[model samples]
Target: MKNIIYVVLAMLIFASCEKPNKIAFVNNGTLINDYQEKKDVEAKFQLKEEAFRKRADSISQAFQEEAQKGQTEAQRLARSNRKKAEALMTGLQQKQQQLQQQMQVEQQQLTQSFQSEIDSVIVNVKNFVHDYGKTNGYNYILGTSDAAATVMYGAEQSDLTQTILDALNADYKKE
Candidate 1:
């Protein structure tokens, strides 16, 4: 009777020790910084901005040259041309405003997309980590990458940033 009671107590203790998994980490900053998809979007936005500036400069230079040529007829024509230039400048200003708005929208959308992609990958990795922890019987699994004090010392093997970035790029390539 004593032996049977001890055995049952041991079984109960073992059962109580078992649990499902919970995972936490600090991959958000790393995901935004290292993600290739986000980098490409930024590059395209820069190219568009540079092209817009060049076109605006060319228009302004043409207007200045016309103003510099001084004859009575030329002055009269310049006055008329100046009004036209002013109207065109207004239109160009409006276009620039529209382009800036478009760029903002694109930036917002790209941010949302990168977030969605990272969330999905995090979910998959969480599932994997849960399995890994359960199999290894780790009651607590911590991401040293998320540690404070400048991440003083973490094994490169444990960083997991490169691994996650690779997964991100692979998913991007598939798309």
Candidate 2:
């Protein structure tokens, strides 16, 4: 019984002497926004959005011109053939509706694609941070943002946002 007590005491002392856990935190918003890959993705999507807008505008302008021409022709026909003019106006209206629908579908598709790419980049950043923590012997790595302060206060030395950002940017450049 005495030996058992001594053994338990020894184990407790040793456990108490063990090294403290390694913990760090990064600014979630900063890390994600400053990541090189994320910036690149945003730039790419911006260009695509601009191009889509230009194309949409061009299509709209051409359709407007066509509609103007059709209206003039319909007016001339109405002077002699009222039924034919009514049919031409109906056809033009249907064509405009179809064009608007097509443009809307195209815009929706582009938005979805852009959102998917952004989601992918966010996932990649999270995975990279996870790997970095594991590789660097971190027991815990917390993320904090202005919206949700999971880590309200941490020592300046414990803030790893810039370090992780640098490493992430370097890795991106390599890729």
Clash pairs detected, candidate 1: none
Instruction: List model 2 lDDT by residue over 111-143, tens digit each.
Output: 999899889988988998999999999999999
After superposition, the stretches of candidate 1 with alpha carbons farther than 4 Å from their true spots are: 1-15, 20-24, 69-159
Assess the local accuracy of residue 27 in candidate 1 as a C-alpha lDDT between 0 and 100: 50
Name the candidate that leads on lDDT: 2
TM-score of 1: 0.44
In terms of lDDT, model 2 sits at 0.94
Q: What is the C-alpha lDDT of each candidate?
A: 0.59, 0.94
Clashing pairs in 2: none
Q: If scored against the real structure, what TM-score would every candidate get?
A: 0.44, 0.89
Worst 10 residues of 2 by lDDT: 117-126
Q: What is the Å distance of residue 168 in model 1 from its true position?
A: 0.7
Q: Which candidate number would show the highest TM-score if scored against the true structure?
A: 2
